[model samples]
Structures are given as structure tokens and as C-alpha cells.
Target: MDLIIIAQAVGLFTVTNIDDIVVLALFFAQGAGERGTTAKIVAGQYLGFTAILAATLAATFGAGFLPEAVRAYFGLLPLLLGLRAAWKMWRGDDDDDAPGSNNGPALLTVATVTFANGGDNIGIYVPVFITVDHTGLAVYTAVFLLLVGVLCAVGRFLATRAPIARALSRWGHVLLPAVLIVLGIVILIEGGAFAL
Candidate 1:
């Protein structure tokens, strides 16, 4: 495996998912005293992230057969998602869809939230994955999944610590929407959506 590919995978995954730490921490905190909650969270994270990567890989392959003009439209999904997130933020609406401490299956609830929150991830990843070869994509996927485990550990740790959790919560909620909006713009420009 190339070191450059590894480095790129690490950097890209970290930048795209730094906000997840706060989310996972909060989830962990909510399920702190419950048995099997940690396992459900970890499994759910993997399940959701795997689905995102699967979609990204499919889009990367599909993009090869599509015309540039059509491909440019791919940016719309993230742009709309970002706009929706910003609107919610402005309205001071909590993520009402978030998984709660209900008797329902925690894994499914967490997976749903993870997948919903990953719309921007698909937008960003498809472009990058399109640029990489098969080996590079495999490496990126492997690295990403590994980092998910690390993220879970970190989130669990943060749940046990109040200060860091609070600090991250203060910023993560505000930062992700902005990042999504910027990423949507960047993806659009890169794909020449505006030019089209």
C-alpha cells in the first residue's frame, strides 16, 4: 500500500467526519448505563458508513458512463442537504429524528441517523473516489472503517468525560452545517455545475 494513499485516506476521513465524534459521544452518553448500547452504536456506525461507501463506489463507477453535464447534477443532493441543515439550525430545531433511549432497536435508529447525516459525505466522497483507482478506493475504504472504530472509542471516552464532551458539543453542532454548505459549493465548482 502506498503511504500517500494512506495519508490521503486518513486526512480526508478525519476532515469529513470530525463532527461525528461529538454525535457519537452524545449517543454514548444517552445510552451510558444501558447494557449492549456500546455494541449497538459501534455496529450501527459500521453499518451506516459501509452503506455510504457502497453508494460512493457505485456512483464512482456510474459516473464513468455518464456525461459531464449530467455528472454535474450530482452536487445537488449535498447542496440541498446543506441548505436543509442550515435552515434547521436557523430555526433552532433540535434533530428530532435523533435516536433516543427508547425500547426500539438502537442499532436501527443510530444507523438511520448516520445514513441521513451522511448525505454530504456521499457528495464529497463520490468525487474523490472517482479520481482514485481500484486499489486506492480499497485503501480509502479500509482506512475509513478502521477510523470508525477509533471514533467509537473516542466517543465513548468523551462520554465518560464532561469537559471535552461539552466543548465538542458546543462547536460540532454549529460547524457541520457550515462545512456541508462549503463542501457542496466546492463540489459544484469542481464538477463545473455553475459553468453548465
Candidate 2:
């Protein structure tokens, strides 16, 4: 059980969420310079993550169960999402922050972006969630909920760090997309979604 808890935590919180640090940091940095914006970003993070989890659970265990054959292909979601991010970066569309500049997008807007960016998360979460027993599932859910706050706080702190934040906002476009594409490949292989 302990090992399962750790594995589940790593898989759900860290391994599958590398891209999130970038996105979350971006969200925080987007509002870090503005007063009261950090709270909004944190709230949006929780709200968006909850929605993603709810939807994944429903698809994994709902009336119409998710299929593994299809699950393997879920990897494509992240792989392509990464490519898209990279493309946007190449196109100079990435909203890079200069140390502490942020428009502080609306809380709702932040949530929407979070949800939208979670396409990869949903793809990986479904199979992982379904494989666990109820107890394990509960553990994963609880840990995820708790870690989310920590993740947000870390992101906010990083945003306040000018040098690091600038680098992340600048090079994140390269590193994050590469990581996501690799993650997608891993999920595809590990989930046996491409066994065919």
C-alpha cells in the first residue's frame, strides 16, 4: 500500500505533470506582480484540476467505460499538444514575462486555460485511476488535492524569482514541450494503449 501510494503519487502528481509546473508557473507569473492575483491563480489551479479529475473519473468508471485500446492513443493528445506548444513558441506566440509583468487574466480565464491545458493530464489519469482499487484511488485523489496547493505555492514563489522566472518563461517553451512529448510516448507504451 505504501509503495502503491508513492507510485501513484509520482505518476499522477509529478511524472504526468511536468508540463503543469510550466503552465502553473506561467499562471502565477501572469498575476504575481499584481496584488491579490496569486490567490486567484491558486484558486483557478484547484478548480481546473478538480474539473479535470472529475471528468477523468467519470470517463474511467462511468456508465460507458473507457477502453484500453483507445487509451494507448491518449498519448497522442500530449504528444500533439507539445508539438502545438512548440509551434506556438517558434511562432513567438508564447507570452513570455519580463521578470514580473502580468496582465493577471481573470480567475475564470485562468481556470479555463488550466482545464484546456489538462488534455494530456486527462489522458494519463484515466488508465491510472481505473487500475487502482477504491482505497488506492482515494489515496491518489487525496494526495493529488494536497499536492496541488503545494504546486501552486511553488509556482508562485518561482514567479517572484526574477532570474529563474525569466529563464523558465523563455526556455520553458523548448523544455516543456519536449518533456510532454516524451511523457506521451511513455504513457502510450506503459498503458499498453499501442499494444496492437
Leading candidate by TM-score? 1
Q: Which ten contiguous residues of candidate 1 have the minimum total lDDT? A: 96-105
Estimate the TM-score of every prediction. Answer: 0.65, 0.63
Off by over 4 Å in 2: 65-103, 165-196
lDDT (CA) for every model shown? 0.69, 0.66
**Candidate 1 stretches greater than 4 Å from native:** 63-98, 102-105, 162-196
Error of 1 at 74 (Å): 14
| Per-residue alpha-carbon lDDT of candidate 2 for residues 137-181, written as tens digits (9 for 90 to 100) | 788888888888888877777766889778766765465557556
lDDT of 1 by residue, 1-196 (tens): 5799999999999998887776677667656666788998899888978877877787788844444455445555545655775686677765633233222126865564465456467768888888888899989999999999998999899877877656545554455445445655765776677884
- Sequence-dependent TM-score of model 1: 0.65
